[model samples]
Target: MGWLVGVVAVVALLGFYLTFTAKRVDRLHARAASAGRALDAQLVRRAATSAVLAEEHGEPDLYAAARGALDARVEDREAAENDLTRLLRKQELDSSEASDVAVIAASRRVALARQVHTDFVRDALAVRSRPLVRALRMTRRHGAPAYFDIDDPTLPSVTQVTSRATRD
Candidate 1:
């Protein structure tokens, strides 16, 4: 009887542990999804802002580039975003101080959003990859979590842009 009781207790504890792990994985997946949506919104904002800035600056080439990328499909979005960032970094800002400041702020937001998204993705992946989680198939419904791979640009900080504007 004592041996039977010990066996039941062990089984109960294992069940509880598995349940806890499953719940944790679910929460992480939810967090990743929410972060992804926020990141997408920020990317759209960055692209739209860049397009407007390009048009306002009277750079037809830059405007066309930005517009093309802004309208690209999801499969090509990473490349388009990278292209847009590369162009923005290379092009000289011929606008007023206020305009330059606005662009810098938008770019900074994109950088921050990307960082947040990446962090959430990493968390989800870490949880999903745990030995117990995998053995018990905690992520079976969701399959495997994938990271958003992108060559995120290092845009100028607000201070750098402001100082350059002042110097110029």
Candidate 2:
């Protein structure tokens, strides 16, 4: 009877240990997943801001460096997301530094993208319109001669032997 009771007590302790440890593991996994989701949302917002700057500038070269940086940030975000899932499965810290590096890279991208857009908007030729766009060949040709042919006989050629320079 004594031996049987000892065996039963050991089985009950093992059951409690498995139950508590599994719950702890699940809670840690959940925390990691939430952190990863937050990081993804932040990176997505940064990428969108970069896209807006690119569109506003019209010239990709104006923001190519910044855009490339943003792309690297996005790649990092995606890698972080993937690593979160992997960590959940493998329960390891081998890739946590990589995720940290990704966040740093994204922060740098945001700063650079902001600076490039600011400079571009300030120096942008398209942004300035000191003179309105005038149609060259349109009916309202301001600088062109009123007549169709400059040498038309009916209109009298100005460039004939009767040079305008001589007459003037």
Candidate 3:
């Protein structure tokens, strides 16, 4: 009788633990998805700001890169964004111009959003890779989170431009 009771208790505890782990995985996946959406929004804002700057400066290459990033399909997005960043880095913009200042600010926001999205995805992947999670298929319903690999969107000149703008 005692052995039977012990067996039942053990099973009950295991069930509770599995339930807790599954819920945690669900929450992490949800957070990762939310972060991805925020990152996308930041990227769009940065591209739009870049497009405006490109038009104002009469830069065709910059304008094309920015537009490509904004219109890119999912598979082509990273490349387009990388091209836009490369073009942005090559340009010298007057810090005093409102459009230029907006571009710098947008780039900074993209950097921050990308970092946040990366962290969430990492966490979700870690939890989803646990032995118990895989064995029980806890993440079977959730799609695996993918990291967005792109060039660092923040320009090195941002600090200099920002400081100069602030001093003016």
Candidate 4:
């Protein structure tokens, strides 16, 4: 009788642990998804700001790249964003201009958002990769999280302009 009670207690504890782990996995996945959406929004904002700057500065190449990023399909998005970043890097943006300032601000936001998205995805992937979680298929319902690999969206102009302003 004692042995039977011990077995039941062990099984109950196992069940509780599995339930807790599964719930944790769910929460992490949700957070990752939210972060992805935020990152997408920031990327879009950056592209839009770049497009405006390109228009005002009469830069056809920059405008095209920005538009391409805004219109890119999911599979092509990273490349499109990279192209935009490259073009932005080549331009000598005047921080005094309102449009230029907006572009710089947007770029900063993109960098921050990307970092947050990367962290959340890393955490979710880590939890999902646990041996017991995999064996029990805790993440079966959610697709594996993927990192959005893009060029460093941080613009050199941003740092330079910020330092210049601070010194003034």
* lDDT for each candidate structure: 0.77, 0.38, 0.91, 0.92
Best by TM-score: 4
Better of 3 and 4 by lDDT: 4
Alpha carbon RMSD to native, model 1: 3.8
Error of 2 at 152 (Å): 73
User: How well does model 2 score by local distance difference test?
Assistant: 0.38
Clashing pairs in 2: none
lDDT of 3 by residue, 1-168 (tens): 999999999999999998899999999999999999999999999999999999899999999999999999999999999999999989886576789888888998999999999999999999988999998899998999999988888865433434666778
Give the candidate number with the greatest lDDT: 4
Better of 1 and 2 by lDDT: 1
TM-score of each: 0.81, 0.34, 0.88, 0.88
Q: After superposition on all CA atoms, what RMSD does each candidate show versus the true structure? A: 3.8, 33.5, 3.9, 3.8
Over the stretch 28-116, how does candidate 2's per-residue lDDT look in tens digits?
43443444445445445544443454455453642443344345553353444333222222222122344323433444443444343
TM match of model 2 to true structure: 0.34
When 2 and 3 are scored with TM-score, the better candidate is 3
Report lDDT (Cα) of residue 32, candidate 1: 83
Which residue runs does candidate 2 get wrong by more than 4 Å? 52-168
- Per-residue error for 121 in candidate 3, Å, reads 1.2
User: Over the stretch 1-168, how does candidate 4's per-residue lDDT look in tens digits?
Assistant: 999999999999999999999999999999999999999999999999999999999999999999999999999999999999999989887777888888888998999999999999999999988999999999999998899999888875533345666888
CA shift of 138, model 4, Å: 0.8
Decreasing lDDT order of the candidates: 4, 3, 1, 2
